[model samples]
Target chain A: MRDSRGAEFDDFVRTRSAVLLRVAFLLTGDRHAAEDLLQEVLEQLYVRWRRVQSSPEAYARRALVNRSINRWRWRARRPEQSLGDHDGVARDHADTVAVRELVVGALRALPARQRAAVVLRYLEDLPVVDVAAAMGCSEGAVKSHASRGLARLRGALAESSLVMPITGTGSSR
Target chain B: MTMNDSDVRGILHRATDDLVSPPGLLAEVRRGGRRRVVRRRAVLAAVCAAVVAVPVAGVLDLPGNAGDAPIASPLLDEPTRGDLATDDGYLRQVRAVWQRQIAQSDDPPRGEPNIVWAGDTPAGPAAYVAHATVHGMTVGFVKPTVDGPRVSTLTQVTDTETDGLEQAALLGPQRDVLLVLDFGQPVEFSPQLRYAPGGKVERTFEPVVFRDGAAVLSVPPQRTKLTVALSRTPVERENMIHIDGTSEIYFPDHKDRPGPPLVRYTLPGAEQVWGIDPVAEDVIAPTKALAEYLDPVGAHTHNGSPLLWVYGATPDGRRLLMETVQYDDDPSHVIALLAGPQLPFEAVASTTADWSAPLPVRLRLPDDQGVVVVAEGSALSYRVGDGQWTDAGRNAALLPATATEVRVTDANGTTTTVPVGS
Candidate 1:
């Protein structure tokens, strides 16, 4: 009986690992850290597999966001490593690389809560309510964080010349 | 080109395009999960043992007294004699006893063990550990004696008024451990312990008072020396006062106040302190009342200095008075001067006009490296070193470490320059 349940968990992981990994990558802004974040979430989910298996995707996503935010907060107390050192991807066009660098740096510069709000709102395409649920805050808080996060990112991108002027409001999704 | 939300999404997708989880990620996670489940079971068993042991030990007083019993058989599987030699070994022994306690009981909920302290106790070598349960945090003492490892539940340190463990410390020559049970309120009361060498744990009814948000305990090598100081910057908002500050522990004999404080609590810059002033009278009146209250009971003034007093509430809403005596020749003494049933906040507010305002001290900075200080007046200004005095807005300010002097000006245009120690 336990074996069958384990098999089900294995199947869930196999099916959802890629999407979860993508979300983790966007949340952490680094491939290595994303892999670590996802592994931790999966391990936690597995420990309480009976309950979490019912809503595996939702539980996994929430855990990822929470653990990512925790990691961001912990990293804030220590000296940060240079981003270029952790970029595992091969260099492509210099212009594209510079643009990617600016965008990633801007995302990292936002406070942990704001960064989480942006990742959930844009990359995961979660609704404002769902993002709030994932962040363990209210919908108004989510909207406030997202708005401030986007405004900061816009300012950063403009200063770096990575993108054109940012204007107009956007829905959370 | 201004990037819209869609463009932002597109860029995020590209950033993560090449990322892939390791091939053995699933296997690793599964293995990690199994280990976590095992630990969880062990912790649950321990909590269950504690919950059951509380009543049985209370009724039967099992294992007799610590001094009388010949070393019983190893309660836990760990090597007691060899392991008790080192701190790491002793902690492992402590963990083993905790695990054994859990293993002996029926299935219970799992929780984390906060190892408060590991050192030589009067009962030999011991470690203080606490685990949370559905009810509250249960503190335990694990002692590794020549006979075997002895584990006993100290007491349930919290009630429904508070939910979790905030801070803990083992103080005094007897290694009396103090546990702060709640942090939700500005004022916190911690239970102190008196450990008889033979495994007898007696809880002194007199609680350690933490003024503002400060909880600190200091126990020097000399058994007679102990000092507890609670200091914080007072902030008033929304008709209530917030007491948030740092706590420092000092020995009375240390004239130069050498080295760093034994313990310090630095709250975040953004965390608000909130609580009602439990005392009804004016600050001086309350101080005098408290002094008169303690005088008959052997509480004396520390020299000629005015008695410094702080009033707050326990988790259960009881009013508590904490006072300190500064002795010129001897070390300063701090105690929980008085405690009584709840006082109505409304009644207190009605009588006192400035109960929520900052305590009046011209300027009070940390005696150590930091130049931050809490001032009393509204139109307050401060200067660090010989620099121009900047407007400090009647709150705390973190100045440069190289600062040589601190100057503060009050709303009435009175300025005072504090002499910085070399």
Candidate 2:
């Protein structure tokens, strides 16, 4: 018989991969790297599908955070590999590409944990509790990180010509 | 413009609305899941096998696949080496940190973490040989982050814990590293590349520093060929732990120079091979192997000249580029890739590289992304079925998914068309 777990995992990926993929892309700010990250996470989820099937999205989200944080580690030591901006342009959004670059750069520059927290809080639009869960930290800590990240991104935007109104002390909403 | 949460989401959405999650991800995940299962079985067999001279922790060298990522380092019984090895003060500090972790943990460690090796890195003083027991152990990589000394648990092998051992790397909240480890065995650091092109195994090992039980290797920054050896001795460059998905950042002094690369083809060209990134080096220079392979093809760019070429990039920006290594000893179209913008350059696509009859390489970049293309020659271009030819550019390019043929033209204007598909 076809494996029930495989079917379930397949269904989850088929249905949720779009947003998960977007989460990864926003977190890494590189298209290929995002796909790579999502694939790896999904692969792990498939292996542990039985255990995490109940909350596969939560499990996958946490794994994404850990891996992105690890990517930060990778960058520190294995600096030869990095996010290349050669062709990350969205043809339909050419007008806002410059704005997106500023946002991505500001986001990418934050501390790995802070970046994870902020991306989860803002881009994924997860609650502070969910961000904290994904990041393996306290909700209070998530708020602090997101606040710092939002402020920094705002500061970066303010300094740049693309001054995106990404201003907030933190994601109070 | 005051950015709110909606603004951020809307912007990020617009930026990536085009990335519709590349097709066949489920299939890719399944294939990788199967591999992981098989790898687990293999590890189980290896562990359950009769204990020999050393633990047979050799990563299974599946043809055309990258090695498994190592998270826990093998327990070291050998003597330690690190300038900080003798530093009682720093050692005490590192130990105190470990102790602090042990004292604070809800689920405490079985025993004190044995500081296997300690070294003064460009980052700061770091230690190896983390919390362990007889059967399994947790790899704790301590690094000086902007915050403080954080002990990020990488992974656990059998029963212990491991987040993902970045052995050559000291993983924490701050760093991700790839490494080779030997559990409960000692393999000295002596790299001997049996680099022969004619049916002989070509292996190039990065320079490794061994401490008591832990060893720190200087991994090549360039795209490297995976070396899967079954030798129990260190001569085979055994127990290489690799991780995937490395990308662009600076801080060139990440790894200690493992002497000089095999060959350096720094061609002065206006064409930005990698666009102001560091020149790609043949860390495992292909001189002899390269000559043998290329001489047969009768295809080469001369004078140790290196030409950087782009395979095609995805509209969302993922691309592959290779540099032709034509070094000493009449090097011809010898191949290597500059991976992405700042990824390591592995010497080749696979072990069975034959330039005479060019073969497509099945690449498993660290990002877990795979792309296949016959990335070769000085200048290349491709075309789909009955379509216009687009500049493949440089030494090689990722074959477009719909590409039916690749037209390879040398500087001499001799053109050869090879049917290509991914």
Candidate 3:
């Protein structure tokens, strides 16, 4: 039974790590930082694996969000903390790399909480309630943060050469 | 500049499409977890021992134990350990950085920082075991440079956190090479990292003395890919296995979730066997009406595990599906097919490998039927032979038989080539 549980946890990490890593990358805006954050969370998750087996994905999501926020707060409170992002990374003009960099740059500009709210609501397509739960905030806060985040993204991405205007379907509630 | 939620969603997916979790993460997690369990057990034993021999009231009144005492942080209790622990000048420099950073921080520590460990590493001058506290939580710190010290990369010192085998890639004084490794075990495991950046693969072995489970290595700044190998026992340099995971140019694909449990779909007629299950349901009907007209394909199978079938459809109101097929003295394979009301299902395409992520199931039908692609993100597209892309419907798409690549484009015009390579 213990072996089975271990196998199950390994399976979860193997199957869901890509999605989870993507979420971490979106939250932290740096691949190295994202990997570091994910390793830390995975350790914590392993410690609590049995309790969260039924819905490990949910637990992982919440952990990622909380840790990202905590790291941001720590950086703010401690100047020794590495204040790094994608700013110094060399730009890749290749089709895929360029677009991804532009998108990440736009996201990195937003505050941590707003970034989380926007990523959860729009990128992950979680409902307002779920987004609120992930970020430990109310639905109203998620909506406001998402709205403001989307506006900021629009303004930043508007300057990109490949930007395209999307018609509002009003379906993304 | 105005964009809708859909636009943002697409761009976000585009941005993160390439981020894959590093390999060996599970191993690292399990290792950390075991350490934590050991720490927990040790703590419990210590608590029990303390209960029996509770230190005298005043003796136990340590700096942090007594309430609101104007003493140094509790982290200072442990004497610093490392080769350079006695170097006053180096320790002073580390202390200065810690004090300056803490002073500039919003919630400054109540006392001076403790310099625990400082020494030269492959990544240059590095320090670990430097401790500080805010709000009573002890955080461990490591400064890797004399130029700019960024201690944020360090994990906090805690009851459960492992003091052994701390591994991190940190920026050093040069800012060009940043790698630090702590293998908190007594064994002298030789660590080698193979780096191949679109060119010839080179194995770089780090040189170090494992002083109390800490070693630092330098990895150049420009790195395209990395492979890791650690030997439990030291071995000759030439005898070690050199080709460690360099062939795996990219992450192995795995599904986010297992497919629906294989159930016996009984229509009792004649279900034809498609070479494999429909990989991309570019067009699919909700009802199993297509399956209703086919023969009971699973019933006919006489060998191996029972066939698992997933049904789908095509654009021209035809039946399409993918399923498992087994042959005499042969391993089972997944096949896709196309059929009409008047025709029996015939094998169109098949994949001999397991299906999963950072990639999609890509199968090109026999005789140029078309290419079918099933992937994570919906709203995908495919193009064949350098032709313009055609929408694959939703998460799955069926393209012309000549289609060589599957591409997903966000609303913001970012296109990602879904992994459909051979």
Candidate 4:
């Protein structure tokens, strides 16, 4: 029975690994770090495999955001680990790739809760209610996180040449 | 639809436009409906192991294959150290030797050692300890694995608290008699001490175990003169640092640095500690026990953030780097570079916007000879067999063993290596 169950779980994992990796990549930017983050989150999922199969994506997304936020938070302490243009690209050309860089920078600049809210609402495109459910927070809190996340992201974008527009300040959309 | 923040919103979408690769990720709503079926069965099965069943949506579509994506190797060969070396190596060696001694002790710790205090050493005014533990786990392969006593030094009379009738005897200025409340595997250590209002400080520690359980501590009767109750409230991790994802930069000194820090909070139960966004400069002159996981497979030359390497020194002072690069076919494993003791560099230096922003660079012994860096516009090429740097662009040359004085050529044909002094 254990073998069968493990096999079933393995089958599900193999089929979905690629998709999960993509989401993780988008969430983290660092491929290797993303893999590590995904692995840990998956291991956690494996520990609770039974309940996960029902709604794995939501659980995994939440875990990914939480872990990413923690990683970002901890990384902030170590100054030498920041990602800046080091590929020897010209300053003018640097802005060409700045879009991805700017967006990721904005996402990372947010507080953990706010980042999760923004990712869920904008990137993940989930409704406010679902975002709240995934984050284990109240709908009102989710609304606040989204608002704060957008505002912070906007502030971050202003520094770069690429400017972005955000929506939903605080009240109803 | 329309707003003043539209520019930023559009820019945000554009930046993250190609961030996700498999494309169908955001469009997974239909598949989610099907996942409901799988979650029901999974929950039923989890109930048997007595493990808490996370909600179905939480892990419904998680990846199963370890190598679904080309994985970067976490292990690598220790790199050669050139300059910034210290006796930090002694820390790891001592830990190993001490762990062996602790394991050989006929009377092992009662259970997992609850950290009483952890920080700097010598147990003096400058030193800081995390918390006290009643009992500690047996120093074995399965659970708690450390050499010698869990806490290296017992600094002051106020270092630990006691519970039950266990007694505290001053063994020495360096070592204190730590009474264990229980003596067995999976033991519980919970000590209650009388904390005088301001004098009795509550050091908030980051949460160690996500689950809540009862812990037992060993303490002397006199220490528990007053039983101060502990709150189960969760506190935000203060004194924190963050690594921005896109920039690959670390913001160590945030707006929250000088605030009142949390001293006592959580327990240390993780098998290993990982430092995510380590500033390259921070790793140059590292403290003891700061080792990190490096993934070579993940190394790639992005526009702004190119090479991302993670390194750390273990509880034993050995520093290692998980050097990652994008060109490697295998994006899973990291090439481990053990910077020699002479210049024990751990993490890579994060690049700054102004290019020359002064970042904190720690050296084991600043008075000693330091490293010199030269950036040359001339192309550098090296093969496996080549011994040193050559002007020849394509020829493979033997890589320099340590972080040494090197000439780096910027995008423009400019080159220079700065000679650094302690």
Per-candidate RMSD, Å: 25.9, 17.2, 14.8, 22.5
DockQ of each: 0.11, 0.14, 0.20, 0.11
Better of 2 and 4 by DockQ: 2
Better of 2 and 4 by lDDT: 2
Candidate 1 per-residue lDDT over residues A86-119, each given as its tens digit: 2223325465456556667888899878888998
Q: Work out the TM-score per prediction.
A: 0.35, 0.36, 0.45, 0.29
Candidate 2 lDDT, tens digit per residue, B301-360?
122122223233332343334334332223233343334454543334433323444433
Q: Is candidate 2 or candidate 3 better by lDDT?
A: 3
Candidate closest to the true structure, highest DockQ: 3
lDDT of 4 by residue, A48-159 (tens): 6678778877787778777776775322211212111221211233543666666776676777688777766765567888888778889999999889888777666666
lDDT tens per residue, model 4, B1-422: 22244464455445433322121111121122223324445446545433333453343322212212221111111121211113344334434444444444433322222222112222211111111112212211101113322322221111111111111111113222222111111321222322222112223222222111112222233221212122222211111111112121111221111111101101011113223333312222221212222110111222222222333433333344433222211122123334444664433321111213121111221112222121112333322233464342310111222323333444465554422222
- Model 3 scores what on Cα lDDT? 0.52
| Model 4 spans with C-alpha error above 4 angstroms | A1-32, A68-96, A163-173, B1-422
What C-alpha lDDT values do all the predictions have?
0.46, 0.50, 0.52, 0.34
Docking class of 1: incorrect
Q: Kindly report which residue stretches of model 2 are placed more than 4 angstroms away from their true locations once superposed.
A: A72-89, A159-173, B50-422
Error of 4 at B178 (Å): 49
Number of the top TM-score candidate: 3
> Looking at model 3 chain B, which ten-residue stretch has the lowest summed lDDT?
B293-302
**Clashing pairs in model 1, backbone N/Cα/C closer than 3 A:** A164-B1, A164-B2, A165-B2, B45-B102, B46-B102, B66-B198, B71-B147
